[model samples]
Target: MDSISQLPDALLLGVLSLLPAKDVVATMILSKRWQFLWMFVPKLIYDDNYQNIEFERLSRFVYRSLLLHEAPVIETLHFIIRPKSNVVDIGVWTRTAVKRCVRELIIEMDCSSSSTAPVMLPRSLYSGCSILVKLKLKKVVLVDVTSPFSFPSLKELSLKSVKYPDEEFVQSLLSNCPVLESLVVKQCPNDNATIFTVKNSSLKSLVLENQDLRYNDIGAGYVIDAPSLEKFKIRDLHEDRFCVIENEMPNIVEADIDVAYGHPGKILSSITSVKHLTLCITSSKDAYPVGLAFCSLVYLEIWTLDTEWSNDLNLLMCVLRDSPNLRALKLEQLDCDGDRSCWMEPSSAPECVIWSLETLELVDYEGAEEEKKVIAFILRNANCLKKATISTESTDPNKRLEMLKELELFPRRSPNCQLAFYYSP
Candidate 1:
């Protein structure tokens, strides 16, 4: 105990910062030297489920700790409020954290178990806190703000299941953050914003996950104008929505798009410069725009759905034809219940298969007749192919051996190509 106590106060506070707020405060009981050490810890995390404490007790503890904390700058202030907790108390806690120069603030409300309404954050939060570098809010309501404010230091922001007042408010809030580099938005059903517009020039990464369950014919969509984006991801399961990109992302390095939208030509044309892409669309017939080429695409992953085989094959051939520099390809069979349609070979091999293609992977391989035809065509045409891996979920050893034997009989154009098989199940 004496040796531990001899360590510097800064080192002791560092250790306390890793623990929960309640545990940090309990360290005061160890010795007189540690009595006031917890007050200087830069990070405070308070979760109601941590100790199963009552709401009232947790509220009081947060209030008292903020009042006594002596840190000049709170690096992080995280809170997980219970559903029935007082909104006024939450406002007070946020105001206090802002005053303490909190850099990273996270407030998550658990509303899944209770029928209480979403907690509206204090207006002071939107107006103040110029020093905040990162902010994350979940299950909260963002009311309209008339006051002018800007988060000059904020670089990362995440909003999950948040309710917004209107489209203007959403645009105004994003416009205020001039230098935000990363943004994540998970939309809720009927959240009032019909078209979410993000026009940030400095944004380098963006993730959009839309869970909107509205069945009406009223169209909902997104307008993205982030030209500096290096990485982009979107997962929209609703087929009624649309996406419009205002500018091309020349610097984009990777993208993951899984949408059910009918026509995604505009979205596809904007991301032609991506080096690595993962794509899953509802309809692939109109997947590419006219004269659009993926000159920079090096790695491609296509998620095949349980749909018409001809459409899926057409999409695959169209992309492979345009991606002249593609080096690696992955086909993930999400479902294998499609019709066993006859496979028709392309008139000519794609430039990628004859020139740069090196690695191929087929996940969830079912060894269907159509699947075998597609695999045989790639092996016969890919002159630069180095390795091919087939992962199957079949449990029968005899079926697996027969599948391997069929694949081995296919003619390979590359002399050094190695074929490997795995039974996943």
Candidate 2:
């Protein structure tokens, strides 16, 4: 135990950094050296989720920690504050505490107070946030002030359950984060008349989920100009005008397009470079692998379309012709009806088949005759296929065994191939 206590103060401090903030406070009693070590920890996380009342105590904790410690450079600052109570000079005190050491700041504030309106943050708190490289804000609201906000060094940002003063404010925030690489916005709406102009070049990942906008507003004409974007996920419920559009994102490699039914062609038309694509469509004709292509596509998942197995077959034909390098295909949550005729392509259609296809996975498969036909078609064309995963609902023993028997019949021309069928409830 003597050797243990003799550990360097810095190394012991590193151990405490991994502990929760509450636990770190308790370690102050470990020894006198530890007491000073906790003060040097570069990261601080304060979670008030356990407290249902106001976050008045959180301000006190910060005040005490800052007064006692003289940390030269802080790294991460996280606070999830509960609403209602007031603390004197909180904005200024918090701002001073986060002068330079903060490279990442995550603030989750509960702003739904019963009083007049949610309390606004003081202008000084965000003055130094430009140095923050990552930020995740939830349920927080900020007002407009003469101080034009800017965060020039931010790289990754995720905003959830939060609101900006206006749509222009949102765009301004995006513009200020010049080198931002990843952005995620969910369940937030700006003023009705405001327009959010999105323009960034370094953004590589973009996710717009649950964009709640008023009717007839047609969503602030979003213009994405990120040429290096490699991944994109769009989930929208409000079917407004299907005003969705995809700007120049040629580097996209993997994407999931979840569309609302009324908006057929809402998804962007040009995703030619995507290597793996998943379409969550409700209509058979809602989308077809058309002019846009994925020559390097190695994996594809087409889910939530018509129950006709033939529809999948026809789409695969288009994909095979375009993506000659396609290998693995994953079909999940497919509800296909017994329609056998959709499997064949016209004689004039370009020859399309997965010559190198190896692995196939079908989740939630129902043993319809036409569905089996599609499965057989894959087996016949993909001469190099080594294994197939057929998963079905297990609630019914008869249907589960039925699928296993039908899929077991596919002649594994390449004995090197094996089929694994699973019945998942």
**Highest-scoring model, lDDT:** 1
- The list of candidate 1 runs beyond 4 A from truth reads 1-11, 111-116, 212-217
- Candidate 1 C-alpha lDDT tens digits along 111-201: 6566646778888898778989999999888877777878888999999888898988888888889999999999887677789899999
Query: What lDDT score belongs to each candidate, Candidate 1 first?
Result: 0.87, 0.66
Worst 10 residues of 1 by lDDT: 211-220
Model 2, position 48, has a per-residue lDDT of: 59
Task: Name the TM-score of candidate 1.
Answer: 0.95
Model 2: number of backbone collisions: 5
TM-score (all chains, Cα) for each model: 0.95, 0.85
- Candidate 1 structure lDDT: 0.87
Model 2, 276-339: lDDT tens digits are 8887765555456457567767888877565665655665566667777777888777666444
